[model samples]
Target chain A: MLTLQKPHRHVETVIHSEVLIDCRIENLYYGDFRAIRDCDLSIERGKITAFIGPSGCGKSTVLRCMNRMNDLVQGFRIDGQIHFQGQDIYHPSVDPVAVRRHIGMVFQQPNPFAMSIYKNVAFGLKLNRVKDDIPGRVEDALRRAGLWDEVKDKLKSSALALSGGQQQRLCIARAIATEPQVLLMDEPCSALDPIATRRIEELMLQLKERYTIVIVTHNLHQAQRIADKTAFMYVDTSNSSRTGFLVEYADTHRLFNHPQQEYTLQYLRGEFS
Target chain B: MPTPAQSPHVSQSNSMVSNHSKRSPARTSPTFEVSVVSPPSTTDVLVDRGFRGLAYVFAWLTIVLVCTILYEIGGHAFPAIQEYGLSFVTQSTWDANNAQFSVLPEIWGTLSSSLLALAIATFFGVFIAIFLTQDFLTPRVERVFTTIFELLAAIPSVVYGLWGIYIVIPTIRPIATWLHEHLGTIPFFSTPLSGPGLLPASLVLSIMILPTIAAVSRDAISAVPNQLREAAYGLGATRWQVIPGVVLRTASSGIFGAMVLGLGRALGETMALAMLIGNSNQVSLSLFSPANTLAALLANNFPEAGKVEEQALMFAALILLAITLGVNMIGTVIIDRTTRRLTGGTS
Candidate 1:
């Protein structure tokens, strides 16, 4: 977590390298309306974890809670604990900005800032005041996101000029620029075409070599292709609460090939979308 | 476009208006017909055409009014233009006792004082805008402050002049005198405090125009998409960093448009400057020295002027008109451009 927190450096804390982010969300709420309940998930270091669920199942909501992105939302409150690198992210003294610095995010929409491509990618470094080889780091980040070949020549041009795919890639480059340990993507390629989605899936696979990834995807095939671990979630509409909860959590292959919970099996069998 | 529920009845032969749907039918609403659609009446076409013609005339009135003003002022100014040529503007000497007139000093005061006021207003207006938009205050409290700022514009300019005379001048006089006495070497602070001068007039002018700048800037800052703020925060930007770096940068062009619009308002300010600027005809660098603006010149000298003085004042009026119109045109263009750009025009 990057903070102006006194004498505390904003860097990666590696207490247990295996589990980078441990989330045990008892309940999440938007004002009085409870959104999610009873979800305990561990995102391992350097692996792609895909969150697969139907719409309104709080997949994106839980992904956002990992990085404290929901703090910006009005009346958003969470109960229980999400410990990132052994520190409770919801602690009173913890700075959301610091948590965000160490863990970046990519939104469903490809929203590049109203600036040049180079500047969009370099936004994190300049704001975080990272005293490094800035130009070199920018080039590396762009190349890693696989956008350098397309946008390197037009670095100074407006990011808004890029195609949807290129802009999504630019966003990914921007997220990785600050060298965050975990990257939370909420339907990042949902807005892109099939080819663009394929490219991003490949990029995510490559990115997991260095960074932890938790993605919320509606496309189950995408989870089958790229995710090492998969979490299945369903909305409980029985008690008029309409709360979403985790139904199944396991290895992607085992969950798909083997039978577990009846709800999970019914969901996999296309009983209801 | 009217729904069946809106205008429930229709007849084949009737040149009449609706008792319920008194106005012309809407063109946008397309949903929720509780019953069958009404047949089109013949008078509907007539009413629509009539409304269009009326609106056309009203639109043309703006152009007609502008042309009429231009012709009247230009005709009155012809004598002065013939006597002095365009050099009437550049020549500084204005000896009214000798029937000689030039607007160089008035031009200086108009541009310099308005610009200084704009600079001061922009500083405070931007801070006020940021405070209003950033959720520092809740929506209800923010509306209260917004209304208060806007109420500043509702006050008459002469009232501002009165306030300047009674309050603003006296409040700053001690500091003005102290600065003049100690740092008299600097031209800006060289002149001793007086009742009315450029500094006091500009301070009041800044206050007068503050609402315009603050309101427009608040709209601009508020128009910035929330997604941009999220993107910046997701990149680890603190609240302060996101403000100046992302939010301000995104809204800069709109804020510039707000300044330009405020300048248009400031440039044409007449009654206040006439009363509070002390209406002197000399150009001086000191803030405490009295000066004259083109608006003030026209306001002060027009009623009692001889033939040539009236012509010269008309010329100054034409100049002021051109300046304010040109500024408004530029401001409109800038505001339009900012809107399109922020909406993500490709170029």
Candidate 2:
């Protein structure tokens, strides 16, 4: 196993001493195609870190790597280390299923199971074999997700009957029911209207008080609105084949207003994107 | 002076009429010309009518064929039905010399054997589908196994009968004897006959229908969307957890439909059961005792039956047809209800 020492360039002055996840992705490939190259970044504990880039820039790929969700894809292999807390998650002995239990994920589309709302929220708890007070824990999670009051009377109804926004919130409740330490969202609001988008943004902001968040989005303004730290990635077309690399990483306000790299500045201004 | 007055009056009249005609062009000669054109060509009209006639004829062909078969069978069996007056189905005696016939034993045999076959097929078929469709095997290997299963269905029924008589019965006789010795307290395994009987017949029928059930079940399992699987795995479900909870639940209706289709095939089987079931006329509790199904009875007796005896056989055929149709109707209703529930009643 490769253990990476904390790199010197990590921006520690903006945050306190707690660093929850430190990612150093040397390379990621699918079959023969390289997707991400030489990417390194750190996630601050209990804060929202956003990965902002254009489409096909490997932003979602990096986010999936955090919880080892990319292992589901055939022929997907990673070459470097991803350390969660102090332990190497990519080591041979670590089971991906157990890794996912501690780090939950919400996809771009709201995919509640083909079951009732109560079952959808309780699915994770049952999988982990929780022995007592399941209904209480489910209601607590639903309340935290801002969905309990709306769906309190009809928990037995099908989840598909809910509106798009409510379904997304239900998905959030399902993810948080297990009380994972880290939450990964890959464009969680890309499928919702603006009003629903704002609600989820507020929810994410509230969730940051308890869990570390890593989000991937093509909506630059959404990243600017909620992220504490932002990482900008762009496709590297200088080589024979295109691969994505991290261009700049900084506090969200600084990266948006006064970007350090020329590419990041151009991307912010929507110049030739 | 007279010519100038006349010319002014004529020019004024002509200008007034021309302005009126321009205001109403929609009702004038241009529209009239379009309306006066000829109707569609004779060949086009004839071809359209011909195609419609052909379609009507094809649609009625199935109805006509069914009515004819029913009419012929009813006409032949009318004497037997009138004479027996439902006793044909209630009594078990089938003496050919005195022309007294009954199908009670055959009815019992057909129902018990087919139901047992269906139960066994459904149990193993669902597991096979789940195994083949899951991530346990590579796609190439899965394809090979699927092809081998399909080949089982393609073999002729007579071949299965011959194999059952030669290999399956002899091999299973010992086990049947052991079952009689150990579990004989249960009526199902009570008697120990040394030859072909209901147990071997049902086992052969189950093997024959296995491929059909497995194929349909595999299709059902594969039809479940990837999103459902992903949702389950994303919530940290193990492979075992995801299968029965998510995949099987989603495919339950389809599996039920597959079992019904296999039952239909089993109920109609003739040569295979005739060869293995020992073709006896007794209704006993022991599966080791010899028995006769309705289809096997027809196949065995239809060859040299007398006039009244042939009518009895036709009556038996009619009963078989009615039962199969009833089973299919029930299956369709259940499948419809399940599909409607799954789709939230829109279907």
Candidate 3:
């Protein structure tokens, strides 16, 4: 709702795709510990952007910042600005709940409410007062998340009764039911097995057609397989305390094949600190 | 003169390894020693049997205690039951002068007073649970409130009775009169506040059980994992939407169990109700009128009762026991099922 007009847009960004989220982060800290710094990136609309890095590289931290999820953490502070739909999400006038309604997120673990599967998907619609046909919207959202058929017959049963992978998909369905502009996923497949992981990877690819997706993944191969653009971040250990910063951002093919930085190359080649 | 003691200690430390080898026979045995796993000795068998016998005796002592109480109460109640038959419970009059007694009014008093207390306690207890569990207040303030709840539970019932007689009666008498004046047409507020009555007793009972309901509801609410909160928030839910919509719904059964437990405590409260309920053997719909519960009736008359009065009082005690015990059993079952269901696992 608030306009941040000081910074100009990054020109020639990501295949010249329309910029959906313009982020300019100078520093991020939690109670005196710096997590990430100087990470500026633009998320293109209807595109799958992957962040691949090792542990503690702030890949998840950066992803959480997109939806303002980090605001829930104690003493979490950000010297940054993020604009979505040409409005600054962190402005005092802009409510975090309203920001989340526009930008949804799925965590690393599958967290379904104890309610029935139907209620889980319909929760957001009811909260946002989507006066449209609720049952129809729930079915459509589940269908888009690729969980409808498996759950259609037992829509009234508890969501916890579903398997691990199905519950994760239900979480995805719950997130997308509100029809958010962007879906931020923080290692959505980390807790799942390989089969479940592959099915979700396919689901992500399908979902990218409608929603702009930003995923932080430790799986290099998975990112290479699905992402259209990839940003690589590495832990900056030049000082006494190591913190994460962006090393390279480009098309997935260019970043994988001919990386711009030696850190990116070493990370791709399995060389880690 | 004592210098040789240090020299002896140094010699023992120097040869500690050799001492262990000589002292421990197990060190020389094979890795698997069959003798070490041999059958129990005679002393072990005797000790085991003696311990088992003592445990069995203690277990049977509890059963015997329960049976003794049941037999004594039933024996004394036989005279009243034989004379009055089923009419004893349905009849309205309790005339010890004519050797005629009934328990309907006492039953009404017990149920109405307990339920009224439960309703009031539940209202305040649930709000206390929500405000305490949610991260709205400073943790220091939350801790202070939690300590107050525990202190409320720790206070003696007799003290509550004294407070009810001296403080609660004088305080609520005016409010009861105002309601009776404006709402006299309604049966609940029909009568004027006669000295000690159902209204004051019920208020004191609510204060007594408020801690029970609040503590149980707090545990149930907190048991809900933060993951569910995250899930709800991630779906764009505001705090108000999330509290009743998600958190309360998830812990509903547990909170119900807590109310049931509070009802159990209210049903069996004797001293406080005895002091405040006026010990009148009459029933009326007006909460301002004096009434007597089975617990207070038994507590008040048992010391001065003659033969027939004693028999009737014993009957009252039996009914009180059945209601309170049954309520407690139901509460325990509900709490067990829901806590296991709510906290089974988190995704």
Q: Model 3 in CAPRI terms: which quality? A: incorrect
| lDDT of the candidates, in the order given | 0.87, 0.86, 0.86
TM-score for candidate 1, residues paired by index: 0.88
Report the poorest 10 consecutive residues by lDDT, candidate 1 chain B: B1-10
Which residue pairs show backbone clashes in model 1? A1-A98, A2-A98
| Candidate maximizing DockQ | 1
Chain B of model 1: TM-score? Answer: 0.83
Indicate whether candidate 1 or candidate 3 has the larger DockQ. 1
Candidate 3 whole-model C-alpha lDDT, 0 to 1: 0.86
Point out the worst 10-residue segment of candidate 2 chain B by lDDT. Answer: B1-10
Relative to the true structure, candidate 3 has a C-alpha RMSD (angstroms) of 9.8
Pairs with steric clashes in candidate 2: none
User: Each model's TM-score, in the order given?
Assistant: 0.88, 0.85, 0.85
Candidate ranking under DockQ, highest first, comes to: 1, 3, 2
Could you give candidate 3's per-residue lDDT for residues A54-127 as a string of tens digits?
Answer: 78889999998887888778779999898887888888888788878878889899999888899889998888
Tens digits of lDDT, candidate 1, B89-135: 88777777887889988999998899999999999999999999987
DockQ for all models? 0.28, 0.16, 0.20
